[model samples]
Every structure is written in structure tokens, then in C-alpha cells.
Target: MTKGYIHIYTGDGKGKTTAAIGLAIRAVGAGKKVCILQFMKSLAYSEQKILQSIPGITLITLGKPYFIAKEGMLTDEQRKTWGNHIRIYPAGHPPKDYREMTLKGIEQAIDAVSKNYDMVILDEYNMARWYDLATEEETEKILKARRPEVELIFTGRNAPKEILDAADLITEMKKIRHYYDKGVPVRTGIEN
Candidate 1:
């Protein structure tokens, strides 16, 4: 029996990528091929290290380390905090080589689907579209072109309406409350 493709995970809360990663792990454990294209994120986290060790699973990172803040609208403190969070690329700038990397990652994911991978996870992809790094039409084309037998998971907040309408399954993580509102910072191994 062929598995249906297309899942969208979105909302103002968290756990989207975490859920997708869990699915990827399960797919790899079942001896099925799995691939994760991590968009708008750098490869510096512990999850990346752990997931890369899994057999029959591929991980591709397409973003340089940088905070995705609103342009020209950050306070000094916010700027400082974001500066700490941003990953400094080898070229000392983000968006320098990110476009090519993202495009390549997309192509690689498509190729993996064509090669009969059981699942593909596109992590933080919604943020890419939200930030205007990738267009909604382009994402739609990619999803529409996916092979029937390959399942796909998209993780991120604020997913586009078109994507939600096209998805077979959609999970929204609404943020009722968050510790960040109380001035809590992200913890390593837990938040990272």
C-alpha cells in the first residue's frame, strides 16, 4: 500500500519540528529511507548531531546563523540578544550563500523523494516563506510535484493558506502561554 504524502505543522507555539524529527526517526528505524531538509536554521544544534548519526537518514542544512528579526525595528537589547543567537557564517554574513544552499537542499529533497525515500521532512520551511526567502508559489510547485509514495512533513509557524488547503494532515500549535513572556531564555538540549 502506498502512503499518502503532504503534512503541514504550524502555529504560534512549538513542537512542529520536534514532531517531524520524531517521524523521521521512526521511518529510519523501520528500515525506510528518510531525509530532512532543515531550512532557516544553522547546523549547530545537538539534534543535528544526533539525527546525522542515524542510518539511512540524510540531513541537509540550508541556512546560515542569523536571527530573523523585523528589518529596522529592533531595540538595542533585542539586537544584542539576537546577535548572540545568530550563527556567524564563514563569510561573516548570512544570506550570502544561503540562497544557493536552500535551492540545493530543495533539489536534494526532491531527489530523495524520487529515489523512493519513505519520508522527507522540511523543517522550518514555513519561516522561509514567511520571511520571503522562498515564494509561496514555488513551495506550492514543489509540494505539488512530490511523488505519490513518498510522505512529506513540513514544520514551522504561520504556514500559508495554500499549503494548509493542500495538506492531507495539518497540526497547529497555538501558543496559549509561554515562559518566554516571563523573560525565560532558551535552554540548551531542550530549546535548542
Candidate 2:
């Protein structure tokens, strides 16, 4: 039997979640089942529509509606536009609802790895740990308990060293340049 290794996509750049989604699609296309447990995000992005359309894919989002940002990270325009929905000041202590959602996501991920899916993708999991929404030890325990044939993918920035050391393949997506510097809002089908 072929061994399915653990993979991680981490760094400051984008495309980590996108890459995991691509792999999930490939697995489903090859007649394998995929389960995506999204942490710290609940917005139904454009990709969610397509994921719902995919037959062998199960996508679950356990996150709050608002995105977390540092106090000074939001530009004046952004503050004025999305001030109501944004969370600023001390990104470490996320809202109780978000924490609850992320904990639920971790539980789902554990279940997915143990008995449900051929491939399990923990989207934005690193950030979940960084934000105190999840714990590295609990997640690692799940990884160790997963079936040998199950493929596991963890995506996010600032991945803990413990996770990197456990993963068989680690790819860091470095950010060289981004259109956000050019004053471009996230487009519906593109960045969203």
C-alpha cells in the first residue's frame, strides 16, 4: 500500500489555501474522497460554490464572519468601509465566537482524519494555532492517529516548528509582490 504523507503550505504569500483546494480536486477526480475543514474563516468565497458542486468533496467552514487584523493594519479607507466588520487591536485574543468555531473545526478535522476522508485539508490551521484558536499538540495528536493511507494537508502562515518537523513535505509560499500594494480591492472571482 502506498503511504500518504503529510504536507504543509505555509508563508506570508497567498495561494496556500488555493493550492490545497487544487490538490483536493485532484484527489476527488482520481476517485478519492476529500474533506476540507476551514478554520478562522466562514465567508463563503467564490470557490465554495464550486466545492459544493464537486461530488466527492466535503467543505466545512467553521469561522466567524469578520476577519482579524492588527490595530494599525487596516488602511483608513478600509477602516471606513469595513470598520464595523473588522477586528482590530490585539489580534491575539480573537472573539469568543471565532474561538468556538475554530475549536469545532479542529474537532471536525480530527474526525475527518480518523474515519471519514481519504484526504483531509486543515485550511488556515497554522494561523488558528497562532491566534490561540487551536493547539499544536491536539492537532499533532490527530495527525499521528490518522490512517496511514490518509493524505493530510495543513495550510497557513507562521507554521509552528513542531508541525514543520512532522510534515513530510513543507512548501513555503514567499511573497515577492502583491497587487494589494497597487491599491486593488479583492475581486469577486480572483482574490476572494
Q: Give the root-mean-square deviation of each candidate in angstroms.
A: 3.8, 2.1
**Per-residue alpha-carbon lDDT of candidate 1 for residues 66-143, written as tens digits (9 for 90 to 100):** 665545556777778777764333322235456667677767766766676788888998877666566666787677
Question: What lDDT is obtained when candidate 1 is compared to the true structure?
Answer: 0.78
Q: What's the lDDT for residue 36 in model 2? A: 90
TM-score of every model versus the real structure: 0.87, 0.90
Instruction: Identify the leading candidate in terms of TM-score.
Output: 2
Poorest stretch of ten by lDDT in candidate 1: 87-96
Off by over 4 Å in 1: 72-76, 84-96
lDDT tens digits by residue: candidate 2, 1-192? 568889999999989999999999999989999999888767568898899889999989877778776566678998888868877656566677777777777778888888968999998899888776777777787777788889999999989877888899999999999998898989988877
Task: Give the CA lDDT, 0 to 100, for residue 126 in model 1.
Answer: 84
| Cand. 2 TM to true fold | 0.90
